[model samples]
Target: MQATRTDQPSASPVAPPPPLSLQTRMVLLSYFAYFFYYFCRKHLGVATPAMVNSGISDTTIGWVQTAYGVCYAIGQFLSGALGDRLGPRIALTTGMILSGIASLAFGLFPIVGVLVIALSLNGLFQSTGWSNSCKVVAEWVNPVNRGKVMGFWTTCYIFGSIAANVVAGTILARYGWHHVFLFTGITVAVVGVIQGIFLINRPADRGYAIELEERSSPATDNTRSGFMLMIRQPAVLLLGLAYTGLKYVRYTVFSWSPYYLVSSIGLAEESAAYASNGLEIGGILGLLLGGWVGDRFFPGNRVRLALFALIGMIGAILLYRVTSGTGGLWGNLIGLGAIGLFLYIADAIVSGIAAQDIGGAENTASAAGIINGIGSTAQLFSGIVPIWLKQRWGWDAVFISFIVIAFFSCLAILPVARKGKLTKA
Candidate 1:
């Protein structure tokens, strides 16, 4: 009766975390690199009011954003492949420097045609940041702990958005809007130079052999075969479709919320910019929680968690629409926070964790690029359609559209959720 069970196998040992110094270096580098990427990207949104006041129509400004989105979407595919081939270190540094130059051009020449061309170039360069940074993380970190690691790491964008708004708002208040672009461009370029000097592309470069999960694709290098292989995955395609709706919702909020506050709520320009921080603050929390909960509770099933978050996002949008008119500043802030929390929970899972899991070690950047590229297409409409809706049917129509988009985003993943996990096809 007291005999021990000798035939039963013991549980497998959990892998130890990556080397502390290497992990720290990778995390900090990727975090800051992507963080400054936002500086060049988000400054346009902050400076929108000044642009409008300078006799640029809202529709024209929307078209400028649309131009940026188009090029950004196209660049995702090319940059993802480049990251895989040339190494993320080169791709990332080049993108940052070039993006900075583009921003400078946009600021120096504020004419409509120049604004379109500059922002378009900026969009293309800005595309390099995410996929390459993702490739670096995939190389340095093991998949077992990737969810938690990427969770905190992904907050770079959220924090970047917050910082960009604060800095841009302050700069706009103190100096003219032109200074916003000049300062951000200079800052990002310097950071790019520093990142180029210090970034280590992979663990092997540092003489460490980190264990990685094997993927089904043999051509995992930054080659055409690998790109095709990743694009063919059903999960990747589904995730991309879902991300389209999600990105539309996110870009709309990011691009227009300040305008909404100023125009609809009667807030001053500076106040509108500062209040927008509430969204990013909630996003930071969402990403952290999503990463922790996905790894701790769901393990390999990030899509399921993402589905839950999508549903929550739908609810938050609805709540925001209902209360925004009567809720005042506090109400708007609360709604924005709630919307950010749920939206980003789905966002981080779909674009970051799930993409990593599906792509594994080999095609990390390609998978991310494909998914994000598809999602970025929504930015085209996000930039222009909100303006159309607001002009034609008012703000309520715009939010109603977001609610519908969030619901469809949730539905896009239902088939994958039924399969019960994210896996390569």
Candidate 2:
């Protein structure tokens, strides 16, 4: 009996770490892909003031943005399912290339109707970036380290936004607003081509052992069942609801902060664009900290950490509203940075970490799509609501409304926080 112990060992051998070279390559490529995707998407906001100066009404711009939001929301659902079916490499490559084309078209014709149509197409293509890119990370990274990994990985957007501001701002100041789109559009298209050539979809494609358990079966292989499976999960629904509020605030800030600085605080367009970078800079730090703390201390739990950050977000928004106009540039910078810090911690956790946890390897992209889709529906309101509020009440009312939204966002996740921790579906 004692001699039959060959199969029973004192301990299990640890799996070797995933190949660092492959992981790093995938991460860097996806990071830059999404990074430039923001360039095409965000330059519109930077150019809005110039557009207004050229005789466009706030209402017209709002409608154009609303069109983009509608298309983007619909595309999130479709692209997510497609990513699952076709694989991330194809989905991501196609999206980035098309988005660049749309952006270039927007710059070529300055008509309001043309702007509406072009940005709508741009929005649809832009929707493809996040869910598929997240899917890529989910496929390549181990679940055990996903929080920390995605934490750092999600910074692509934050830094992307910052870079877009700097680049777009400088271009607007020197060449013209039209050149902003032309330059960014060409760059993202090139990046997409490079990614299509080199990017691998999964570790197994290259003969490495898959790090996460893949829960795929023929029963849940199709789009409808995968969507229903995610929707049925209580955590997914609650996270989606919570993400709606967070995204509304985030997008509103992205779309309007530069305008606010220019119109209200008396800053030049380029200066305002540079100042807006404070938000993303703060976001970079917050995302990194949230990922590290959640992975190291909370382990499988992310909701509780997000709740704390959401509460902090409420206070930060209040501080930003109160100090921004009175405190001058430094005050405005500090306030925006503070809001960014808290908002992104919660944002990264709910949108990235929690979605991955619930979706596991099989349904990661679909789950991201559903959650982000629901959240993106708020973009419809984000485009019009602040303009409506600011027109009717004042900028103070805009801030107050978002404060209420932040509070409700906290409420949405409270039930999940009480239950403690999520496991793979």
Candidate 3:
């Protein structure tokens, strides 16, 4: 009977593991979706010289860019609403497939009218990538870490731009500019199919129920009646205003810097493409630092970091202007890198991090659409503004205008910097 007595060991309670796979997959799919989107968007910058050689005037090319910008801005609202309603999987996959077809068509057709139409369609479809992807990422991530998370996530644009430049430049060297478009198109189409097969629309879609548990909160009261209410929040309005100016300067560089190097600074076309890569290369650092600063120093207050970035951008633009005149190739390269660093710091903070803070998971797509749509509208003027100024007042005026825009953009966010702090999860 004594031998039969036995004791059992006690067991401690165990908590469920975190949904790391959900976030990992969300980040990867969204990253590649936006990454390939740039393939269609950026080829125009590399192909401008070829376009000019084929009889497209600089003004005509500007108009073509404007056409894309106008359509893209409008499409942002539509596609964003659709993404919110239909889910990311459908919106993004459809957009990519169409954008790929459009890119392929852009390469095949050399006629100016036809090319304009193709680029416009490409712009429309490409608009789907950002807002939908934003919605998806917002659902899986918490606001407390959004700055750091989105900071790294936003690098897709920088890396995508760099990759497009290298690939396009290499193809321009070996196979020709048309092949650049062809290669990128095929790549985008392949990525689109992969995303469609693998991308989950949200945490709830895959049995992760955290979002559902939080549905009782006010932020998740995402009915049509509440949509406008959320979008009109002070953070959204102020960030949107600041982003307009920031996006103008960003698009100016993306649209015409290579052409400026070739025409004003006398670099060869391929060299200009390679040099433009420096801007994005420097942006990688800016984005990482911006996220770190926002998370570490400001926490929920992203406007403070954005204000700093805006000031830095003004100085960098002025320095780059001077470098263009006297610093020679290496100097200009360094200057461009600095400008990119500062510019994207502001962009990653305001456009990527702040938008998520204001929108939350439920309203993120709409918020992204509204802000990005308004910001992109500046592209309409960005295409025409610098070109007109360069034609009349010279490159000095063109650079000065960017300084003025940065000054105002900094001012736009000051009130938010003083009054707002983003909420934690």
Q: lDDT of all predictions, in order shown?
A: 0.85, 0.85, 0.80
Residues 185-251, candidate 2, lDDT per residue (tens digit)? 8988888899899998877677676568656565555444666788788888888889988988988
Give the range where candidate 2 is weakest over 10 consecutive residues by summed lDDT: 216-225
Q: lDDT score, residue 164, model 3? A: 89
TM-score of each: 0.93, 0.94, 0.91
Question: Can you give the lDDT of residue 66 in candidate 2?
Answer: 77
Q: Candidate 1: lDDT over CA atoms?
A: 0.85
- Worst 10-residue lDDT window for candidate 3 reads 207-216
Q: Is candidate 2 or candidate 3 better by TM-score?
A: 2
Q: Write the per-residue lDDT of candidate 3 for residues 314-333, one digit (tens) a residue.
A: 88898788778776577777
Q: Provide the RMSD of all predictions against the true structure, rounded to 1 decimal.
A: 7.5, 4.9, 6.2
17 in model 1: Cα distance from truth in Å?
9.9
Off by over 4 Å in 1: 1-18, 215-224
In angstroms, how far off is 394's CA in candidate 3?
1.7
lDDT of 1 at 392: 98
Clashing pairs in 1: none
Clashing pairs in model 3, backbone N/Cα/C closer than 3 A: none
